[model samples]
Target: MKALITGVAGFIGYHLAQRLLVEGVEVYGIDNLNDYYQVTLKKDRLAQLQDKPGFTFQFLDLCDRQGITELFQSHRFEYVVNLAAQAGVRYSIENPHAYVDSNIVGFVNLLEACRHSSIQHLVYASSSSVYGVNPKIPFAVGDNVDHPISLYAASKKANELMAYTYSHLFHLPTTGLRFFTVYGPWGRPDMAYFKFTQAIEAGTPIDVYNFGDMKRDFTYIDDIIEGIVRLLPLAPQLEDVNSLEQSTPQAPYKLYNIGNNNPVALVRFIEVIEAELGKKAQKNFLPMQPGDVPITYADVDDLMRDVGFQPTTSIEEGVARFVQWYRSYYG
Candidate 1:
């Protein structure tokens, strides 16, 4: 079988491609390799993928409709996983168009391509940020996410709606995974965990937003990839409109919250990092920034029921693993 993975140099995408290639699947991976955080890190990821068998790397942007159309025509990929996006909540406040152009427009291009292709399944990344200040704990796949505080969250929500439309209109089979704060080895440097580790290691002060009162359903990258792997071949059949709240669209479409069902307090999360590195963080507590939410908890009951898998990695285990990789990579 063959697959096309967008943002293949990204943390989750990179791990997914590696796993599929190892399983003897031909993986065609593409990334614009934008300098969102660090181009070098993305290239480093690409370097590892390049050495693997049954893996092909391409320097392409999803916004290029001609390129994407040609790609769909040429590859005949059975599966497509779109992990590419303009990530970061705070960044979205400053640069909103990036989210619209890359996240919204680029997504439309991919969806159009999928509409025209014989694609079996298209699984794309939604986000926990879509929950957006809901007083409700344990954000579920069925919850109403109509009010998003950040453009980033809004863009992800838009993706879900657009995907539903395509699935309904064209009979396309699409799955959307609403990810929480995903972290682990080869993770994005812009993530709180990575920045916290770096600052603590450098003996500098790390900014603790909302005075460290926030909590996040921090998922390990391995766990995220495992969920996608299990859902790859299981395309949904159209269901009744009354059952829509359960994450089933009235089309060959489905959505699931693919995250750790556990939420970790930001302060406690920092403690785990400190324990791993044996260094205390000098925190500069501050008010919540714009587009910031106090907490994100995932309701993965549906995922567990359907996939028979749950994210079991503790914050302690995941942090220790990340610190080990960080020390080795930076040394």
Candidate 2:
């Protein structure tokens, strides 16, 4: 079967597409090559998959209506995975328009294409940030995510709503995965882990937000991908609209929290990274900034119940693997 994966040049997209391709699945990938961080890194990722059999790529933007429709009409994709978006909470505060353009308008275009193409299933990326300012300890899929602190989070929430609409109106099989603090090799430099490694290696001070009091469910990339791979075949079956708490009530729609299910303190996470790198980091603790959350924990019972998903990688091992790849990639 053929799969069309958006944001194939992105960290998660690259890894997911690689996994599917290795499994002998035909994959068509696309990205606009936007200079969000460094286009070179994105290009480097795309280069790795260009020569693989059953792998093809296009330089296209989701906001381009005609482009998206034309591509969908031409390719017979059995599955559609939407991973492209304007990511980062802090950056969202600066360029809010980018989020609306890519995450909102661009997403609508993708949904339109899927609806017209009669795609079998659509799996899209959501963010834990959607549970903004919730006092809840571990964010659950059934929780109320009406308050989003950042535009990026709001756009993601909007995507979930839009997906449900398509599913209800067209019976489209749609699944949304709320990923939390995903990190590993070939990760984005804009992420905290990548930035921390860069600063620590250069003897620079690493910024610790919320005075190192924050907590996060730092999930490894492999674990997140495993959850997605398992859920790929578990399509929803549409039923009646009784309550909003039910995720997959036979309505051909579902949502799951793909996370470590263990929140690690920021200071502790940094300690693990330092231990792995065999170096001490110069820390610059700072108060929480706007559009930032104090903690993010995930209750992934639904994921486990449906797919037997469990995160087994510890921070120490995950950090060590990342450090090894960072040294070789940048040294």
Candidate 3:
């Protein structure tokens, strides 16, 4: 079976592609290699997969309609995983058009391609940010996410709506996974965990936002990939639509939260990083930033009930693993 993965040079995309390659699956991966973070890091990721057997890398953008259409026509991909997007809450505030072009327009292009290609299952990444400002302790798929504080979250919500429309009108099977704060080796440099690691290693100060009162359901990359791999073969059947009471129509569409159910405190997360790195962080406490939530807790009951798995990597272990890779990669 051949699978097409967008954003193959990204954190999650790289990990997912690696897993699929090990499973003896033919994989076609694409990435624009934008300078959203560092071009070198993305290129390094591609280098790892470039020579692998049954793996092909294409430097392409999701917004390229004609190019994407040609790709779909040429490769009869059984599965399509859309992981490409302008990924950062704060970055979205400054560049809203980037989110529109990548997350909105690019997504519509994917849906249209899937509609005509007869792809079996289309899995895409959503975000925990979509639960914006909800008073709910553990965010669930059935909860109301109409109020999004950031344009990034709004674009993800738009993706879900667009996928549902395609599923309803064209009978395509689409699944959206709402990922919590994902971190590990080869993670985005812009993320707090990576930044904290860098600052502490450099004997500099790390920014502790919200006065270190924030909580996040930080999920490990391996655990996230495990959940996605399990759901790949299991598409949502139209008859199963009635089982879920959310905004799900009588279509082959589903949404699940793939996250570590435990929410770790911001201070505690930093503590883990420090312990792993064998150094103390000089923290500069600051008030909450705009579009930043106080906490993110994912309710993975639906994911567990269906996929029989949830992210279980502890912050302590995950952070230690990241530290080992960070030192080796940067050394």
lDDT of 2 by residue, 1-331 (tens): 9999999999999999999998888999999989999999899999999999999999999999999999998988889999999999999999999999999999999999999886788999999999998998788888899999999999999999999998888888899999999999999999999999999999999999989989999999999888888888777777633227655444678888888989999899999888888889999999998999999999988877877777878898889999999998888
TM-score of each: 0.97, 0.97, 0.98
**Where does model 1 exceed 4 Å of error?**
240-249
lDDT of 1 by residue, 1-331 (tens): 9999999999888999999998888999999999889899999999999998899988899999899999988889999999989999999999999899999999999999999999899999999888898888778776778899999999999999999899888888889998889999999999999999999999999999999898888999889989999999887766622226555547888889887888999999999999999999999999999999998898888888888998889999999999999999887
C-alpha root-mean-square deviation, candidate 2 = 1.7
Clashes of each: 0, 8, 0
Q: What is residue 20's positional error in candidate 1, in angstroms? A: 0.8
Error of 3 at 42 (Å): 0.5
- Candidate 3 local Cα displacement, residue 24, angstroms: 0.7
How does residue 18 of candidate 1 score in lDDT?
90
lDDT by residue (tens digit), candidate 3, 1-331? 9999999999999999999999999999999999999999999988999989999999899999999999998989999999999999999999999999999999999999999997899999999999998898899888889999999999999999898888888889999999999999999999999999999999999999989999999999999999999999998887555235666469998899998999999999999998988899999999999899999999999888997998999998899899999999999
Candidate 1, residue 115: how far the Cα is off, in Å: 0.9
